[model samples]
Target chain A: MDSIYIHIILLALIIISSIFAVSYARVIRGAIILGIVSMLVSISLFLLSCPLAGIFELSVCSGLITVIFISVISLTLPPDEKQRKVNSVSMMKKMVLLVLLVLVCGFSLYMLDSKNITFVPLMQNVQESIDTRDNIWNLRHVDLIGQALILLTGLFAVVVLFKKDKNKDKK
Target chain B: MSVENILLFKLYIIATPVLFLVGIYAIMTTRNIIATIIGIEIMTKGVTLLLASCGYFNGRPEMAQSFIIIMIVVEVVILTISAGLIFNIVKKHDSLDTRNIRNLKG
Candidate 1:
């Protein structure tokens, strides 16, 4: 009730992993970092009391998406580019970047404090809190159907695009 | 609101813009198509966090949860399809560099 250290820690981890995911040159390494980011984000969401979303994010993004990205990376990446070792120079650059991020965050928080900014939560007068499952099934069933349709369409498109041509004998 | 909740909210609010910028920077600077996709995923993460925090603040966890679920599903599907398309392009062009795929007049 007072403070949640785990939330902060997970959020910090997510931030670091996200930065690395975008900055890393190697697709495999970036994908792995993105997975880490997703896992940390899911944990943070769970800590924030959104367990269902967290679970979906954990299982889907961290698990499913990471696998897809890694598979694609392996398939498309050049074999010769597979084995680049991270030397001291790149490590130094990362260290410097990390320090810069910390400084920027500190400065921004300081500025926020000086500005006397306050966050106002919206929708403060909702009379009742509904069950998430009920909300999904009853109120949002239409959106649920849309999501299913989208998932099916995407799956179909990918399968069609990747299917091996049986008509190669024509050549 | 409790101190932890407020702190969490602030952290996410600050994080959203920072991560968004990082994602944009990655997209702009990276030459590799896969890296660009990674950047897009990072951007989506930023937006998702922002949405979740808004839901938390509004005390509408269910609404937020549903949106997040929908977002995650859509993001994964988009990423998969884009990755497949990128793979196809790479097979045709023999290069993952975006600049190499420029001449599409045929």
Candidate 2:
């Protein structure tokens, strides 16, 4: 019973923080709110019996991603104040409508008969105590290789994108 | 499954789609490029929740956790590359507005 309540609270926090994340006028504030959303998600993952994923999310999404966003925001110039004010007013109006839509959707889904829905049957022959580490290192080695290759590609991309072009500088 | 598990699953079903909607609306309504990326991140979060819940209910938490870990790695790489792109875009345009990039001459 308490677990259900905790999940509900976490869901509400995720939704509210996500709303604020997109609605904030300042990008920095939005980035910070996004971090909060990620944190809540990590907690929810933990509750859902996914401690490893939760740890990764907490460290990568909530910590690394937020820092990356902040650094990007710092590198760029701020938007014009007058333009931002105009945009914010219109955005607020849209946000109100969005909130209404979400409420309606939530109510309708709540009233839904989920019992009618079918899901995959639990695999009885599978090992009940398999470790996530073993699953990743042994069962999902291809994904690990893919991750490494993609990381290398991303590193090269960043280096090329940020490198100063000497010819352009001379021109 | 227990009553509590079913309730948790229901909560995930309802909340995941709501998060996706918010993300889509953000991407649609915002003109800033960074905000678009943020919207994408939000949508990814929804997907993560869905995957986690599905794994939990399916008795395959290990599989789901591995997938999520791989997903996080891919997401980080994508984000880093996008950040680099945004950096260059800002350097050339002097603004973060997506409208400025409408004219693409290869």
Candidate 3:
């Protein structure tokens, strides 16, 4: 019961941070806010009983992705030139749409009658009682192989691209 | 299913869609390509949340976790390549605003 409340609060924080991230005028600021959103959402995922995913999200999304974005933004534009032109009318329209969607979600949740909602003990109900480690090693081994392949591809691509850029610079 | 689980599930249900919309809004409203990439990242997170939540609901957290792991790897790769492309575009066009790059128009 207490934990559920914590989950709700975290979820709310996630939504708020994302909204701020998207709406902020400065691109770097938006990127930073989006990083905050990822951190909050990862915490929320932990509260919802997905600890592994939450930890990965925190490390990868919040940490690596945010750093990548900040570095890219800084590399491309000077700190003094932080402001980027935005379409105000479209921004307003999107905000309005987002507000409406949020309202509808709240209204629907209200109408759904929380008292009737039910849940099962997800971990306990599993007949196999397989450990998460086993699940990864035994059941999803193929994904692990794929993960290695993609990471190598990414590293190679980054190296090749940066190499090309360096050659261009010298020329 | 416990009450806590359902509550969490419902919360995710409400939140993920909003995240998706906000991501799209971010992409559409921002003139800078980098900002649009930020929006794409947000949308990817939302989808990951949805996927993990559904897996948790079905008592298959490992399945979701495994897939999300793969997803994160792929996402970073995509973002890296795209950032390079964006940098190249800036060099060629001198601007990150999508409107200024009209060379693609037929």
lDDT of the candidates, in the order given: 0.78, 0.86, 0.75
A33-109 in candidate 1: lDDT tens per residue? 99989888887788667899999999999999999988888787563453334111245555665566667767886
Q: Which portions of model 1 show Cα errors greater than 4 Å? A: A2-4, A79-127, A166-168, B2-4, B103-106
Could you give the C-alpha RMSD of every candidate to the true structure, in order shown?
A: 4.5, 2.8, 4.2
Q: Enumerate the candidates' DockQ scores in order.
A: 0.51, 0.65, 0.48
Tell how far residue A168 is off in model 3, in angstroms. Answer: 5.7
Rank order (by DockQ, best first): 2, 1, 3
- Worst window of 10 by summed lDDT in candidate 3 chain B: B94-103
* TM-score of B-chain for each predicted structure, in order: 0.88, 0.94, 0.90
Candidate with top DockQ is 2
Of all native A–B interface contacts, model 2 reproduces a fraction of: 0.69
What is the Å distance of residue B8 in model 3 from its true position? Answer: 3.2
Q: What's the C-alpha lDDT at position A8 in model 1?
A: 66
Candidate 2 per-residue lDDT, tens place, A37-114, comes to 999999988987899999999999999999999999998888889767644537566778678777877676766644
TM-scores of the models, in the order given: 0.81, 0.89, 0.79
TM-score-wise, the better of 1 and 3 is: 1
For model 1, name the residue pairs that clash.
none
The RMSD (Cα, Å) of candidate 3 is 4.2
Native contacts matched by each model: 0.62, 0.69, 0.51
The most accurate candidate by lDDT is 2
| Candidate 3: count of backbone clashes, pairs at least 3 residues apart or interchain | 5
